[model samples]
Target: MDFENFLKKLKEKDRVTLSKVITLVDNETKEGVEFLKKFYKERKDSFRIGITGPPGVGKSTLLNKLIERFAKKYDSVSVVAVDPSSPFTGGAILGDRLRMENIYKFDNVYMRSVASRGSLGGLSSSTENILQVLEIFGTDVIFVETVGVGQSELDVMEITDLVIVTLVPESGDSIQAMKAGIMEIGDIFVINKSDREDAYRVSEYVKSILQMKYQDKELTPPVINVSAKNDTNIDELVSRIENLKEIFIQKGIIERKREIRRKKEVREILRDMFIKSIDRELKIIENKNDKDVSPYEISEKILKNIDFKSLEDIWKER
Candidate 1:
């Protein structure tokens, strides 16, 4: 479709349109990449929630229930399910693909599933692009569910307004949470599948971990318990998320989040531009090389000859 028509479609449609926009952004085409740069500058707000844990922590189930609540109250939601499981000759298993089918009927809930594909951070690098598209689409709430994340990917925090870690009882996750790593990133800790034997113990473990690791900050993350299958404590979980938003407002976290999002969009535009420039220049050099130029020889020339300062200046322009 033409750019104006596409823009109209994007502003009007649901998650499906957002999904298409992300796919276009991922393509790195001349028009596609340029459109995203403009689109990102135009779209500025989406309340992001990150639901992450190991594979079977009931995140999908909880998110399904959570979406039900959002649908009733909000205009729309954007969900990105990042499934990092090994491929069946390369395919997502039960994690993002099949699990999300539980909430597929909700018209207001727009879902996109992304195979993790050995992404090092337990999240795709292009996730920011997907999120920007959703923000432009006017989704009131955006949820990104990672199959898992390690200590390294604070990148998830870069885009999230709230980071909610979902855990089940007796999963050895308590110790994992306490190791001076994941605890700091959590805005909310959820003990899902609380019907299990050590559920309360897990809750206590989370509380203990928080008590041990908290800084002098007044807004400490809360440990919430919920059983998604039975729909127990679901309302409280919803309230807790709202509570986090209120806290965000009070603590100026909303502004902090906005600043981060602005920087992210700017960087993404520059990165995509550099990629295109590098690709095109290398191809031109290769076409000109009649003799057998070594790959390193051409690569070094490309690196040495390109005006990085000019590229940087281009990025700085509005």
Candidate 2:
């Protein structure tokens, strides 16, 4: 279908059209790039919340509960759940949707499962672009659920407005090891499965760490204990999220985050374009079979020949 017709159907809330648009954007097709160029300018604002933690931390369960609560209050809510991709097949099971089966009943809720595609940062390369499409589709709130991440995998912080680090009682020691990494990125800490033994102890441990880390700062990350399986304390969690959103807006933190996101996105786009241009040059050099010159020398030749001015003109045309 043409872009105009697809957009018209999107405004009419066609799920099929929405799914197709997301696929196009995720694949980064020529049409998808054109669609985003137009839609991004006309996109509405949506508060993006990122939930990230280690494997088997009940992140999906907590997210399901949060989505249920938000769907009641917002006109539209969406989810981007990233699952680990298989190295051999380049495919994902996308099992997060199975765990969040209940959310399927809500007509105002849209959920898409994405493969991490071997990304070390726990996010797909196209994640930010897919988010832009979701915003253009008129969601009020968007939840980004990352694949089980290690300490160094923190790409979520670059794109999200708020980051919630979910933990279980068993995460106490892990938190100590990750204090400088994932722990520092959280705006809120959640201890899921609070019905288990030592849940409060873990929560207090997390609180103490936050206190020491943010002692001089005006705002400290709040730690909450909840049993997502039992639906306990979900209301409090939602309330805290709402309050934090207000606080972030008042402090201009969200706008600053968006500014940084824009700059990073521009750099990534330029880098990708440069890599493609270099590959084109390399192909021509390969056909010539210059066995006498080393790889480094060929790279220097390509670098020297590159017209930086033309790159700026190309960006302007885009």
Candidate 3:
């Protein structure tokens, strides 16, 4: 089907078209860029949740349980699972779905695995764009699972309304989560694999850290213990998520968060366009006759000759 038909079917909740649209956006072809340039009305109230943490913390399993719980309350749910990319080929194994096989059986749940593609923030380059499409497609609740790259995955914050950072008992993740950047971003912390002996200890550790970090603040993130495999406390986790949504609404923080996200998206789009425009100059500098040119010097030269309007025009054309 053509782009228009695909978009029409996507709005009609056609799963096949939704999957194709994600792929088209990922491809970043001229057609895909054109489609992205088309504006779609935003759904202001849809819940966007982010789940992130270290690998082996059972983020996928936790998400599966969350999907089951969310499905009971919402008619449609979508997931963007960001998996690590292959360093050699820049391709993704897309293995998050392997553990979430049962979730695929739910017609209301639409899951897409995205390769991180060397993005520093643990999300794919096209994640925000794909999320815009999903929002326009009328998904009631959207969940984003990051590449599990630890603290630096804050890019998830740009798109998700609530960020849930998952940690396991034995992985030293509890302490790691308390480190500078990571602890502050979490709206909720989940100690998964709660069946483990040290689960409560980890939960307490997280809670204490939060208490210390936010003692002066009005809103402190809640810590919950749950076993994704055993389905323990999953309902409580979902309840916390729902409650947080209300808090965000009552405090009018949602609008501020959306504003921040809009600014971030605009900055990213401009950065990408600038980098694309500089590609030829960068290549020329790389093949320069003077091998002694420093990286900083080449960068300075590129910026000295960069044309802002030309780059803007190129971006517009794309």
Candidate 4:
């Protein structure tokens, strides 16, 4: 692909070109890395929100409502829905797009589905790269909907400006909601399907837990009850999101988060590059049919041959 032409077309707001560039980036092609290295500095400011929860929690329905509201309010809105990948084929059904088919009619709304590819974090490994590409494409708001997650899948908190944890009346008892991993990561707790009889009770229970957890902190995560199917209290939820975003901006929280994210991204990139450079050595070690050699001894041998000073200098130059 001619990256120069692609960039030009991207500036023209060509959705086709935008999709092509995203595919290139998502696949982590050499051209994609080059394109990012050339233009990542030009990324526009955008708010990233993560929606995550266990299965059958109405996350997609809630996200669809949020997108509709954001699309009307913002100049441009984008979504990345991470779906579970098939273990055998490594392909995803991409069903979130079908659930949110109505939003496609808006010219300002763009959505993409990505396979989680066995990432334990509930997000795709390329999620941050895709978000950056969308930022460069001029989005005002970006929403990332993660695959159905268990308790420890909290990686979304690292990359998003804020995380909304969606739940339903049938999710679990108050004891289940008090778990440390998923509960600790939420900036906002949403009870979808609020029309159900137990929805209010669940919301109140969550609020009490949050109050105790954040009593000393300046900001406490709010629990809101909304029925996505009935379109209940969605406007209020949107208002709360906007309000929290303002506070985050004013407190420089978003900037701090992005700085941390950038540092981690650099480390990850260096690790990946270093591993690829040692692929041949790793293969040679693997092919050795020695039954007596321990894995630790093999690793030590590999480490002995690597020049740390040279690698450090190379990294500094970059």
Candidate with the greatest lDDT versus the true structure: 2
lDDT of 2 by residue, 43-84 (tens): 887999999988898999999899889999999999999887
How much lDDT does each candidate structure score? 0.74, 0.86, 0.80, 0.82
Candidate 3 local Cα displacement, residue 41, angstroms: 2.4
How far does residue 81 in candidate 2 sit from its true spot (Å)?
Answer: 0.4
Candidate 1, residues 1-318, lDDT tens digits: the string is 576667788777744556667787544345656777676666757789988766678888888888888888888887888766464455555345465654667788888877655455466666777787777777889998875557323656676888887878866555574455566777888888888888998788778878777775556788888899899999999998998798898989888887877787688656767975676576777668457878788788778888987666544452
lDDT of 2: 0.86
Query: What TM-score does candidate 4 reach?
Result: 0.92
Best of the two (2, 4) by lDDT: 2
Ranking by lDDT: 2, 4, 3, 1
Stretches off by above 4 angstroms in model 3 are 1-4, 42-45, 150-152, 172-178, 216-218, 293-297, 313-318
Please provide, for model 4 over 223-292, each residue's C-alpha lDDT reduced to its tens digit, 9 standing for 90 to 100.
Answer: 8999998889999999999998998999999999999999999997888767665665677677778679
Model 3 residue 290 distance off true place after TM-score fit, in angstroms: 2.5
Scored by lDDT, model 1 comes in at 0.74
Give the candidate number with the greatest TM-score.
4
What is candidate 1's TM-score against the reference?
Answer: 0.80
Question: Candidate 3 lDDT, tens digit per residue, 1-318?
Answer: 376786678778888877777788787777666666663553335679999887788999999888888887789988988877777888667888877865767889988878878775477788887887788678999999985565345788778898998988885554774467667788999989989898898788888888988864547999999999999999999988988899898898888999898898889887898888787567777666867878788788778888888877767676
Candidate 3, after superposition: displacement of residue 292 in Å? 3.6
